[model samples]
Target: MIPQNIVKQNILDAIAVIHKEGVPKERESTKYHLWYNGGLYPPKYVISVANRFANGHALSRDRFNGGAETNNFLKRLGFEVIEETLATKNEMQMSEEQTFRVGEYYSRNDIYQKLNVPKAKQKGHWNTGYTQYEKDSFIFANVGTAGRTGHDHPNRFDGNDLIWYGRNKSTLTQSSIQSLINPEGRTYIFAREDSNDPKFLFLGNGRAKDYFDESPVKIIWSFDNETENHPEILAEEVNELEIYTEGSVKKVSVNVYERNPIARKKCIEHYGLGCQVCGFNFVNIYGIIGENFIHVHHLKPLHEISEKYEIDPVEDLRPICPNCHAMLHKRKPAYSIEELKRIIKDKVTDTPH
Candidate 1:
């Protein structure tokens, strides 16, 4: 177990390093600096932070030697660090000219490779492993003028579903669309309203017609064009229909509560099945493992509220191990997430002077 003082000091040191070495690049845009594009903090600062934390550790393998040390140190500090192994410098760069590369998109193979775990080789080709919620979360995080445009493209295996919204759609073409897909796989293309040359195009990852004569191809075109309202009929004239020999179809269902489950799981996973509000790990508090469950409580009751309003789970949920959960409401109303986090931070600071 890491000492509380050590954790606090390390975090402070990391922040200090970030402030000093992580000086914003003069050429880089202010927005990029603010967002910590490519990865959080500058590469130099990240390395500094990692070196400070990993000063004495057997696992200080050189595998993370080239600025990857930050990820390792963050992992040690009980934060989930998702490094984009597949993204190249150019792809991940936050410059205005930066564009999405085929490799930047995460796939099942990418996930397996990153996890360093082997599984049965996937037969089908797919672009991204992100669920609907994950995709929407990404969109929400980068919305409006502040958000960069033209990053929203469908993955391979999606059959002509143009659900994405973006700016400057006129530049898109059949050839331009093909460049988005690599030789290894295909990608889904969502037509935008901004494009004057409106035509339904499904770029890659479709079965051969011999495999299946009739496959359900769902195509959504912009409502801006009343004539293009019938996408299925319009697609037939262009022979945009394609078949998949052995590929999986990606489906996205919109739900009211998107990030709640993810936040809950993350809290449990990060805190090690323990309550952050009160230091109650399952084994430490309860002898029976079965009884040692952590419950996620929403700061604002979600179900009671109507679906018309959008709620952010990050601002709402608190993970309390079963013991803390019971004790929290024993007398007064349950504490808000902010209150709980403050209490936990205080407890950690106050321990042993």
Candidate 2:
């Protein structure tokens, strides 16, 4: 069976890729800003490079311009390319499985090249959001800083975001694993091995620990263990001993660390404690009382429980002001702040008055 820790770590890794390389942002209404320093290039060039380095097949002009050229460049650097289009009547559909496969392919190959870097004297810090135990226990086995090295550095752009490169795997105690699985009474997305389907499994829950003997998850870092800096993966070896029937592995609630107090404070500092949803500037409204105000909210919900029962803070909390918080839970079943904003916007746009 695919280990639970590996599944969660992979999901986090995938999310990071999506956030960094999914697409470009626009300024005002006119200028388009690509994530990399390079501005816009032709579609063909981009596609070509992507195809070469990371086996990316579908290159959409509307979504990704210059995809062809990108694929070609990657090929020159030594990477596989896979291109296949679905036969949808109107919109072209690409499977998440395929997208994730491309990401995994690039990540694995990148690790191969990163293994060449000289080991660092001190290990990098681990940010588990609780005690420093997890960070201290980290041992970089192989791999180097994700981007700054080798033939493994594939130019795989999800949209305009840079997909970092490197790999490292490590083990975490069951206690630590519990904290990660269901931090602060919420669940997060994770990956696991499907007993029925050996391909892969995507799950969101706390039951992931049952797959392991001692440690809950085996993390594979993309950077060298000696250096200790960089993201790591939680993985397990797939062998005959782990095989099981379908439904034997089930999804349960678990906590995840996406945002914490420090992160929330940073966002408030950047946005000046204003409600991004309603444009309510706290300072202007409440004066001095609102000085260090504003609450942070998580875009995703975390699971409240796990198999082992662990309590974590970082994975389940977000900051937000009371007004916004109330608004979030105002309706029956509640609505996300973003969802509320969209609903309000639509209502106004359609109003005759």
Report, for every candidate in turn, its global Cα lDDT versus the true structure.
0.34, 0.32
Worst 10 residues of 1 by lDDT: 136-145
lDDT of 2 by residue, 158-220 (tens): 211112221222235445444543345422221211112212111112222322333223322
User: Ten consecutive residues with minimal summed lDDT in candidate 2?
Assistant: 226-235
Clashing pairs in 1: 155-188, 162-190, 206-243, 206-244, 207-243, 207-244, 207-245, 208-243
Instruction: Kindly report which residue stretches of model 1 are placed more than 4 angstroms away from their true locations once superposed.
Output: 1-109, 112-124, 128-260, 266-276, 283-293, 302-304, 327-353
In the range 44-101, model 1's lDDT, one tens digit per residue, is 2343344466464322234343334444444455533333322323333422232221
Highest TM-score, which number?
A: 1
Taking all chains together, each candidate's TM-score versus the true structure is: 0.28, 0.24
Candidate 2: list runs displaced more than 4 Å: 1-260, 304-320, 331-334, 347-353
